[model samples]
Target: DAGVTQSPTHLIKTRGQQVTLRCSPKSGHDTVSWYQQALGQGPQFIFQYYEEEERQRGNFPDRFSGHQFPNYSSELNVNALLLGDSALYLCASSLVQGSNTGELFFGEGSRLTVL
Candidate 1:
């Protein structure tokens, strides 16, 4: 079974630029959630995608958006990135939505460094 995977394990972006990160969910999984983990902190939920639509979302602003494909893979798009956007963007996959007690398998993450 293939576990979650993310692209470009590291990234460098300047302020005001836009960036897109990718994620492939675990095998047999159907739900994907995006999170932003700042340095020295736990991840904060960005949004969740299931059935190719946004099933849920966190407190993130409009600048943060995402999309999930029929194959259960997903993408996170950050527009007009800010310095504060510098963080590890993690992608987590679950077998089902609300079936487990929020236990998630995370990818290594796409590290975005903003200047």
Candidate 2:
């Protein structure tokens, strides 16, 4: 009965540093997607993982990557982080029950502060 969850609710880093964020999908969800939301801007899709593979990716740099585990949990990793990377990292979970338009449940998000 749990919903999607993200760790390190807030993080701080400097340019050139690498950071990893974690997420746990909602109960009965098998698909996990990662998004970045800058202040006053809409969320931008980063990537999505299904069946332990990266099924789709958005217009993000290669430095942004993700992994999905067997338990439907996921991780987002950013290497060589830049000041522009400062944003709220959100994790959304969807059931994908034979349809692609299912509603997505989102976590509170992990806020990243790059200096």
Candidate 3:
């Protein structure tokens, strides 16, 4: 039973560049959520994906996009990256019941640096 796992672990990018981060949910989890955490701030919700569709989104700009595969894995794509995009990208897995998402299991996260 592996838990939520994210890839790239750490990466660096220049402004205007694009990056794609991947995530695999824990067993039996069907929903995946993406979050961004600044140096000292808590995680801010980016979006939620379920059944291969984006079910919810946060206040991020249109440059942020995502996709969920049928196998429950997900990918977060950030385009036209800015310095402000430097942060820890987190992947959380949960089970969606009706309109609510149950407790989330988070991965170690991918650290993105924009220079």
Give a tens-digit lDDT track for model 1, residues 5-65: 9997999999999999999998888889999999999899999888898888899999999
**Regions of model 2 farther than 4 Å from truth:** 99-101
Q: Each prediction's Cα lDDT score?
A: 0.92, 0.94, 0.98
Q: How far off is residue 9 in model 3, in Å?
A: 0.2
lDDT of 1 at 61: 97
Prediction 1 TM-score vs. true: 0.94
Best by TM-score: 3
Instruction: Sort all candidates by TM-score, best to worst.
Output: 3, 2, 1
Total clashing pairs for each candidate: 0, 0, 0
Per-model TM-score on C-alpha atoms: 0.94, 0.97, 0.99
Where is model 3 poorest over a 10-residue stretch in terms of lDDT? 96-105
Residues 11-79, candidate 2: write the lDDT tens digits.
999999999999999899899999999999999999989899998899999999999999989999999
> Which consecutive 10 residues in model 2 have the weakest lDDT in total?
95-104
Candidate 3, residue 28: lDDT: 98
Q: Give the TM-score of candidate 2.
A: 0.97
